[model samples]
Target: MARRGTLALGRHLARRRLLQLGVLTAAAASLTTEAWSSTSTTAAPRFSEYPFSLGVASGDPAPDGMVLWTRLAPEPLAEDGLGGMPNRPVPVQFEVAEDDNFRRVVRRGTVVARPELAHSVHVELHGLRPGREYFYRFRVGRVESPVGRTRTLPPTGAPVGMLTLAFASCQRWSEGFYTAYRHMAEEDVDLVFHLGDYIYEDPINPTSNARQQTVPDYFQVEAITLPRYRTQYALYKMDPDLQAAHAAHPWVVTIDDHDVDDSWAADVPKENSPTPTREEWLARRAAAFQAFYEHQPVRLVSKPSGPDMQLYRRFAYGDLAEFSVLDTRQFRSDQACGDGRVIGCEDRLDPTRTMLGEEQERWLLDGLARSRAQWNVLAQQVFFCQRDFEEGPEQRFGMDEWSGYEPARARVIEGFRRTSNPVVLTGDVHVHAAAEVKSDFNDPTSETLAVEFATTSISSGGDGADVTPATLIRLKENPHLKFENQQRGYAVCTVTRRSWRTDFKILPYVVTPGAPISVRASYVTEAGRPGLQEA
Candidate 1:
């Protein structure tokens, strides 16, 4: 059940006054009218006030357990504002049941939501039966969260019957509603993977969305301060559909460029203009990461320290599937500029350039070599296909993707070939695509290493400004490319022991609020066959 209410500012002010008198704290004097203005504006609902403002969610499902999360906000924005709510810790109880009614409760436990953690609660449940479905919900005071369904992974080496998962990315708040998330919520999936650009870099200009406000610094623009970032995440989390999806299944998420800054590399700034100094940039990065952790259903292992967080990790669904989630942004050479086109930038082709960094690369390769799962799913951001913009030489576009780092791309492909994996799940081109990853695309007879399935954005922009028929012509010049659709929506993958099918779900239009969704295309790759075919 969803909680509803309004917070009166006068009541909060009175409470603050009493607390100040009782403690005789001089700091309480700083809680002036101006400080409370934002909180008092209209009694805006916050995660703490609603207890599920960021919505109920679960993630990182293992064979025996999954992580459940929610923030308890009894008063989202107190008199001091900042959405900090009460300073005291609150007790939150989570319930897991075999049925939606929750009458047959199988698991129940209490976890403390502390102020130090912004009143956020993360309860990791373990020792559950394998390959079983369960429904869960959190409760605090009189409030009950939306019921979410989650499942544990099957036993290792077990011949699992089937598995279904959805992949999506690039959800610009200003573009439109997350109809794709709504569709996914209604889906009976085992898991969900958000492959980055969960939030856009640019601020939501008023023109983009009638409800948006114009702000400066588009990429690092919207979420400058901690409060702003929290508000932004809260705004996105308020989407009922996205909430429903989070409630429906355990999600695996990884951040890409937009989450921090657009096309940001290891220590390099996006705009190249000398505005915020390096120290200021680092501080901003730290703030962004803290906000990200507060909003997402990630483990404490992903907690931010200053401006860095260890985000690359793996999750297994028994022998049926194993996901190698990657972090492409935190450790990569700066984007090549100066050559006019986004891709022709000379530094991109440098062999020393890396996307996953050396340590993570070795970890990935080793994991692939050691895994015995039937499907070795490389759940990651950006396309793994060699995206070249030329019929021959002297033609190219942006080098931010795998196309920019040829050596790294080749190493990944060669690793796949050596390991003989089944498929690679990808997102972040803001377009639907399918490709046959080969060890050597220049050699038509080269062995296909693994199949690549890339989903379009949830709602970014229509085909983007750069993608055109001319661009497609240039893209086709690369032999490994198989299919492409510059559209919006998500990719749903249905996996069996011998084959994996993909349904590329596309929305009518991202610009249109509440657009209808449809299955625009479908493809499949059979076991041992490392390329996609129309389903």
Candidate 2:
């Protein structure tokens, strides 16, 4: 009779556990359905799958540490709309090694992936030696993440020899494969810089075949909610090439307009539209910002809170390079017109109007002046060229860019001139271009202050646009512009004590998968000679 009772109790406990699993599965199913419809191809696959949809990444490396990130979502979409992951914290272990073999282990730790934060984990490792390369990977239970290689910035005041850095932006996943990232991964770069537009907020509309489409829109056509934002990021993070690139090196990231919305100016609600209120927009922005942080390998300083994330920061690579990353979307005045057209829009040209805000601008200028590094790299978004629309006196089109904010642009140029060691690295405009930055674009003989290299999009709008002629016309009008290529790819920059060489790689096409990539052009800026020259 005692043995019979023991067996009965064991059966009862088994039944209870089965009931719990049933409840959890039901809850996940409900959430998935509510979050997204199965009709959309972009809708995440059902939960309980292999190789988690969103890949893993690491970013924002300091002298002794870097941040590792990944999300846990077995079911991205369910009826209840909660992303299908159990609402429980899961333990994740991180291991870093000097070699890929995991033989010489250097750093190891464990962190909890809390479901309240979407089951994402961000482990910031510290106390490691400086200027060393390390391979790292994360694990939860029996599942292991892809192995990634990252390096810490060299110790301050250390005399560094040479550094290779690549910067690119504007990756619309559906538009094309991540050929740029594929190429970037193959390059032996020490660091990668993403200047923004990491993802587009707009849904893929069939009417506009201008950009490629990997998956259909999972959110509503008009606006995005928290779940929608999270799902979008999850979809983007699934790209293998992008994952490979992230696994290759630490990325320094800053957001551009499309990360929130197209042509979004500071604190300005959508023009002539009856949509969500300012508070609603703030909530949406907050959600988008949080999702971005959760997905990228950024540090804790950039954590999101209701549209408030301190994104502008600096990264120094010993005495070789100092990167001043900026935030241009948060504190600027509204665009002159809703369309980002209309130059000298009184509000745009206001001396008080700023792209980096007053505090950030001061910080940047101070950093530039005090920087002891051989190269001062300004990692920013948007074009720095005076991209005026007309070549001659016939007509001048006013578009949103550095040209729209003459006074603010002038201030940045003056700052570069004052420091005399600045190199402005920018993205956006979805086209590749390089220029000899001058204090004045209207004056051909104006003093050249520094140099600017603007990388094109990863896949946004495919390769060359039909406006190539107009682009060439504008280029011819501005003598400061050294070269321009309307292509899809990235710029690989090699910096040495004597010179900086930029190789602009162009992908054959973006609409089709597996597009071939080639070196479209190359430019070099020698020390003491600040302007760009054909390489």
What are the lDDT scores of the predictions, listed in order?
A: 0.71, 0.73
TM-score of each: 0.84, 0.87
Cα lDDT of model 2 by residue, 265-353, tens digit: 66665555223578767777887788788777888878887788999999988888889999888876665544554533455557866
The regions of model 1 sitting more than 4 angstroms off are 1-49, 73-81, 206-221, 273-275, 338-346, 390-393, 462-471
lDDT assessment of candidate 2: 0.73
Report the C-alpha lDDT of model 1 over 1-535, residue by residue, as the tens digit: 0211112243233223322331123122222222111222122223334455566777877778888888754444332223556567677767887765566778887777776667777778888888777777666554556556677788767777578889889888877667778667666567899999887645665344733534333324456556656666666766666776777677999998788777777677676523257777777778778878877888889989989998999987767787899998888876666312463566776899898899999999898888888889888887787776655665565577787777888888777755645588888777788888887766767888788899888878853432468558745687677777777889888888888999988877655457777887899888877777898
Indicate the TM-score of model 2. 0.87
Indicate which candidate wins on lDDT: 2
